[model samples]
Target: MYSRLSFSWTASSWAFALLLVFPIIALVYEGLKPAEEIFQHLMATVMWDYILNTVLLILGVCIASLLVAVPAAWLMAMCELPGRKHLQWALMLPLAMPAYVVAYIYTDLLEYAGPLQGALRDVFGWQNSQDYWFPEIRSLGGAIFVITSVLYPYLYLLARTSFLEQSVSLMQSARLLGKTPTQAFWRISLPLARPAIVVGMSLVAMETLADFATVDFFAVNTLTRAVYDTWLGYGSLQAAAKISVMMLFVVVLILSIERYSRRKQKVFQKALTHEDDSRFVLLGWRKWAASLYCWSLVAVGFILPFAILINYARYYFAASWTAEFFQYSVNSLVIATIVALIATAIAVLVGLYRRLDTRPSTVLPSRLSSMGYAVPGTVLAIGVLIPFGWLDVQINDVMQWLGMKGPGLLFSGTMIALIAGYLVRFSAIAVGAVESSINKVSPSLDMVSRTLGQTPVKMVRRVHIPLIRKGCLAAILLVFIESMKELPAALILRPFNFETLATYVYQFVSDEMLEYGALPAIVIVLVGLVPLIFLNRSLEQAH
Candidate 1:
């Protein structure tokens, strides 16, 4: 019995092991070629430009997002901001806008022939492109603006928690020193929130570095966009893989730095007491200013995009927006729901493995599970295709040997492949949420339950489940929203004719029909809003 139990545990661990490492093997194997080839590509046609552009995008998005998220999180979390309860979801609306979609919208809105410039031209009677001062939306700055608008929510979410988690006693101490609320936040809250902020910024940086669609849409030629160009345009998968390997090294370095900073600071805090953090009243003009700030964020993130979408949706309605739209929406919801559940399940198993807390045992699986967050969507899709393709081939060969014919059941030519790709991409969301919740579950509770002669599984089910229920729900919603928002991997890996709401929007936008695309595109954002709101509500309750 003991041997069987031990083998079962080991089998479980090794099963997850292959799931984690196989994709990485695919990435490395594809990238490895003669060093001469890699060096030649690096030397010819401006690798430095690619690197520089990528760095600039990361830096610009990081700085701009911080500027927006920190102040917003501070106002909402620390002050008595009016309508804080309702405004939370509104603040997070930009997250639903894929960076590529944002690029398309802004380019159309700001371009010479587009509405904004056309209105200006009608007002001033400007004749040509050079006649009026209009910034090109295809430029680096334009890419930065689109990315920062959508990505700031990452920083906002983390910073909100850090703010809400600020010790009430520390705020009182700061007040006794005669510091104002703003001063206290900068001096006290900001410093304390450093770790969480770093975590958030790391996520933003990694995401910016990994983005392909946004850079591709803007035609800015970052490393990610370059990778795709080499792969598809030049028909050099080897060269693309090499570029990807180099990019992977950079991401690994960033992740390492983040881990080091987090370790050095060790600035994790759980709310031992949920006391209010000395909320200051924003009276009269101050209140108006605060409300205006929130409104402006929502306007840029939500209202402007939505209003335009609504205007164009009238056209779709006139065309009698087909039943196909709802069909695709249902398809998207069904897939998103399944993938989110599976991702959460994988996360639960991974978390449980960690709770076992055996040193060498936990190390590899934990690291592998976190790899999803660091990998680009495109790379992950490629990774999924390689292994699943090879696995299908191998299975067919084995079946042939056995005098039986079989097509690839789990992977090839099915919705399962799409879901597998999604799980590979979005598993990090589940892991982060579940691990945090599990950490807060004290060992003493388990100890007491074990003393009552209940089995460990029963204790976890009856006691642990109830305590960590909020975290599980949050994790599921987070993963669901992320999967719904996911594009590149889904675009690449979906079986023929499989369309999600994201894919529907992408099809129109890809064809340069942003106006016609606006309706379903808005639906994507609205659907995403539901999960985002649920996540915020969970986080607030957890605090």
Candidate 2:
């Protein structure tokens, strides 16, 4: 009897999960269809440039993010330096700033006509680009810098947790072997945290791969840009779909590596007892130097960019603070809120199924639902358009047959497509969050509820949902933030005449008028702070 009930629940959960997974399947199906002529054209012309640029960007960002994140994470996790507590959360502030917004802000401040180079020319009596050496902010290296500055937090967040969770006994064993604290960290702590670090690196690699605005703004030709240019520029959706398939293969490889790394887990017998009491202490210049280094990352990543935006807002408030801007903000919040609610509901269904059913039917869909998170926004946008566009055409034809006027593009050319894109892109965050919280609730609780004459649905509502409320809230906030900051998908999927803050910012950015959009950009970052603060507080309480 229980088996029959479980089967029904599993089937229903799979159906819901597959609904979330359909867009990805549509993308793959579209990509797999024949496009031999376009494929040959790409192979002969711009394909290698796209491939090479994407590879180089991922490699550069991975190395740079590790360099920035691992050291700072170690400092905050292991060493007790002045301001260490503040720097720990402060380092995470970058996660709130979108890389493209940072790219625009820094480019504005660093370009020749901007304040930095202008002041430099005045001070050094330099005349032009040829006068003295200045690193171009609109180049590949600048994209790496801006992206790494914002993305390093992915690594830092995981690596620091791994470090803090290290068994104290292991560190003491290293010390007993006559190793210094630094040596112990190098040999013992770092090795123990390798899997976590690699997991973070994989995340950074995925983000670097998915990014479009930073690369597109800098005119760096990547696979993401290739998709955009191929579709919108050359008006070849087939070619764009092909490029997206290639990107999907790349994402598959990266996700495989991440999964393999995560599976190489270490079991520590010793558990955390006291937090600050177990940390290493730093003294004098080393203490100050550590603080300076950590603080510098925050300054460059968030503080400086934020300061520039505030300055721009001061002068541009009248121009930016208008009805149109308010509508854009409303559009952003409305779509994001709807997406968050839907994603969270889907997450709860799938998450509970995975926790209770323990069957292949329930498990596979739950896993496959997350595959979209690795897919680049531009790629997902292409993937989403194919089926939604076809569905719209079919619906229109049916309406005409039924003797009613066709509502053209009822799905593809409206917020429905945009919401679909957001759900496909960010539902994984919600699933992961809710799954984690579900895992923490003991199985005995479910058993108790079942023995007390409760259905699985009632068990979830009365027991699981209340327990995982924090995780559900986190998932909602996270999806909301990501939806607000998302640019490429929103740019492609938004209805005619509709604009979100991200799309609005992209317009001014495309016009090389990012300063005009600076205020809205700042608002996006400010809104992002809600989650960052929540995350930091969560981390603090965990410790």
The runs of at least 3 residues in candidate 1 whose Cα sits more than 4 Å from the true structure, single-residue gaps closed, are 1-5, 35-43, 81-85, 169-182, 266-277, 282-287, 318-320, 356-360, 392-416, 433-476
Tell me the deviation in Å of residue 375 in model 1: 1.4
Error of 2 at 380 (Å): 1.3
Q: How many backbone clashes does candidate 1 have?
A: 0
Model 1's alpha-carbon lDDT is 0.77
TM-score of each: 0.85, 0.94
Looking at model 1, the pairs that clash are none
- In candidate 2, position 399 carries an lDDT of 96
Once fitted onto the true fold, the runs of candidate 2 whose alpha carbons sit more than 4 angstroms away are 6-11, 173-178, 261-269, 358-360, 400-404
lDDT of every model, 2 decimals: 0.77, 0.87
Superposed by TM-score, candidate 2 places the C-alpha of residue 108 at a distance from the truth, in angstroms, of 1.9
TM-score of 2: 0.94
For residues 277-361, could you state the per-residue lDDT of candidate 2 as single tens digits? 6677778798899899999999999999889888888888889888989999999999999999999988888888777674455
lDDT of 2: 0.87
